[model samples]
Target chain A: MTLAAASHGFLSPTGVEIAFVLVGIATLGAALMTVGSRQLVHAALWLVVALGGIAVEYLLLTAEFIAWVQVLIYVGSVVVLLLFGLMLTKAPIGPSPDADSGNRWVALTVAGAAAAALVWVVVDAFRATWIDLDGAAQGSAEAAGRSLFRFWVLPFEALSVLLLAALVGAVALSRRGGGAKGAAETLAPAAREGRL
Target chain B: MHLAYPAVLAVLLFCTGLYGVLARRNAILVLMSVELMLNAVNLNLVAFDVWLRDTLHAGQALTLFTIAVAAAEIGIGLAIVLLVYRNRGSSDIDRLRDLAERPSGPDGAGSADAPRQPQPDTGAEATA
Candidate 1:
């Protein structure tokens, strides 16, 4: 009885493909906006949109596990870090004239050439490949785990060490000139002048 | 299921990032561009994984690692940018030329963070 009404549903392969194309276009637009916006905050927001769009593309590609991971990591943590960086660095919330360099034309030409070459190479290489959307081997958690534990354990552990090192480096770098010695040095000049 | 669709999209996104990295002066903006490029690479990885239909799903697994590494990278990168901003009073890469490129002579020693012209008021000064 419930199956009768579901025959005219929206979850067809054609529907998935359409969503993929639309999301791809939207992602591209958001990516362009991320690079084009003069305001740093706007660029960050645009990055969220672009990253979210990529997550959606992952979903459309039937890699649901990776899609959610993308959301959890990229959208949740990375963008927040970026925002903190922006705030800590005191980036202007408004349009910044200094956001762009004078070498835009040169950069654009180089980027265009790279993009063209990449697209041509990828398209030609994968011209005969087709992914079956309803295949049995879904890129699920189990599959990812199997590969990660069986073949990629060393690299995975190495990444964890790298993360720990990065954490330590961030802490040490940001600590900077923050001790009694630093305070004393600053007060030394004023002390000599009898001001402090 | 044309593989070129996602491939083309990823390429476009990556190139946009490349342009941003090269053309943007702000350090944070360059980091954002780097994130964009990483995202593009992730999309391609997932697409190719699905295309090959591997049982182990190597691409997706590698992508997870990539995302984690990217998070670590941004954390460290932001800390360095903040430190530079605190010391130099500017996040502009052009202004940071002295930080990376050391001068061998004694004459240039005191001019590491010196600006060529008077800089406009950056809000971080009050906080600094």
Candidate 2:
């Protein structure tokens, strides 16, 4: 890894590296807005930008299939679901003063510390490593499909089962009668009749 | 491309999510932050997969699985947030302190009494 990285000097960046850095900066900015914005709806919108930027990053990385999946799943569905949740919960359209918790300063301090430490470690460790993107794309749809069906069949099937379980669990948890108050109310008549 | 770029980006995004999780009041916003964190992991996986060029392409495959699992997670998480909103008429995480230990009073009221009461006293309780 060090040898490969030594061949490719850090001062001279290729076009791909420049693009990746630019998009990454945009993504990071959008992410910061997503977490820091006072308007709830705008926060979700910023999340869309951030996730979309990540999809672009995947494309630049030559993971074509993963890029599309990221677009479809995250940019397409997740943000919409989040928007629906915000609306259903009656989140204020304008900025709300209490968008952040009281311990936000503490949270900021912790996150800053973590970011600084992790960034230092990752940069130092991977400084000598470089990815060779000159060859054919590694994550095209055909390659991904062949590997998925051939090598990763069992995990794929298991993931389907997990999805099904999640579906049922979500339904069960969201139902009206699942709450403690509802259960207590239902059992009140039984206790009144001395069935116990 | 230098591997440090993606690695560093992932770290920053994950920490941003961490901050959001700890600081955000709304449960849905917190869920969005979780998505950010998961996406960061996906970026790292793809970058490493491209670099390694393994025959099995384990990194990309796992990335797909992670995406699927994240989808399921968001579904379940949204359902839970909706349920909490339905029951309590609010989805602010800080106010949902049903499990938080409180100082004992002379009334001998159990923690069970906390969640059942209305949200009016939440601010006072948080201040105390």
Candidate 3:
């Protein structure tokens, strides 16, 4: 079974290029807006845009399963949860006063250094590699599912644990408000009283 | 080279997101910026997935997982931010200063009525 050749000109050889360009542009713009927005919820909504872009890219790459997962998880579940959390906790609900803080310079320096280093490493490592530019066939949902459940079982289990821990931690932190003192003082009694 | 286009786009997304993360003090914006960075990484992964043609579609599959994990992060992260706001009456990154690394109050009294002055509410429509 021969994979599609890199220079074959059959895969997305026409107007699809234009569509990819437009989608990429829109995605970047939305991501910028999300990060630049002062409001918390607006930021989350913008994240949906950025995530949507990634999904489109996945589709463009011919990884339909990954694309759908991007939409289902990032755009649908995650952003909605973020909004719910923001609303439930009654955040400023408006422009954040601390959007511009004194330490911005320091953060900029750190983030800049990190990005530069990463880009340099990736470019240097892969600059000379010959790539096919055609997606793998095993990327289908069935194959991916089988591989995930079979070879990557340990990592999958670990991820499940990590997610569970995060969920529990979030609920604990939010519900108790970390209420001024010991966990026992609040959670234990609440549990005994069936209030938690 | 077609790879160059995706590479440039990925780099642009990464740098812009980094700026937002570093320069913006709002917690929500920081989270959004992180999402930007993640998307950049996703772009790179998909580009490589298409170009190098790895078996098992490793790059694309990992990208899917990354997106999923990011969503889960936002869910928990926003919840924590909201809880912080309820307690301190402000979501200012600078104002949340004292609470940094100190998950609970100093004396175990995480009362909403802390002695600090409260900021005025902006009354804008909630973004959610």
Query: TM-score for chain A of every candidate model?
Result: 0.80, 0.86, 0.67
Ranking by lDDT: 2, 1, 3
User: A75 in model 2: Cα distance from truth in Å?
Assistant: 0.8
Off by over 4 Å in 1: A1-13, A178-196, B99-128
A1-196: candidate 2 lDDT, tens digit per residue = 1232344454588899888888999999999999999999999999999999999999999999999999999999989989988876768999998999999999999999999899778877887788999878888999999999999999999999999999999889866573356333333333324522
- iRMSD, model 3, in Å: 6.5
Question: How would you encode candidate 1's per-residue C-alpha lDDT over B1-128 as one tens digit per residue?
Answer: 66667887888888999999999999999999999999888888888888888767778888998899999899889988876666556688976554464555555744633553234323334334
lDDT of 1 by residue, A1-196 (tens): 1121133234344666667778888888898999989889999999999999999998888888898898999999999999988876667888988788989999999999998788778766765555778855477777777788998899989998998999999999877465544332343233324521
lDDT of 3 by residue, A30-137 (tens): 877776677777777777888788788667766677788878877888677766655554556688766666776776687668757665665555544433434354
Query: Pick by DockQ: which candidate is best?
Result: 2
Best lDDT goes to which candidate?
2
Candidate 3 lDDT tens digits, B15-101: 878888778766766776777788788878877877776655677667766765776687678867765555444455765554445
Clashing pairs in 2: none
List each candidate's DockQ score: 0.49, 0.51, 0.30
Interface RMSD of each: 5.8, 5.3, 6.5
Docking category for candidate 3? acceptable
- TM-scores for candidates 1 onward, in order: 0.82, 0.87, 0.71
lDDT of 1 at B48: 86
Candidate achieving higher TM-score, 1 or 2: 2
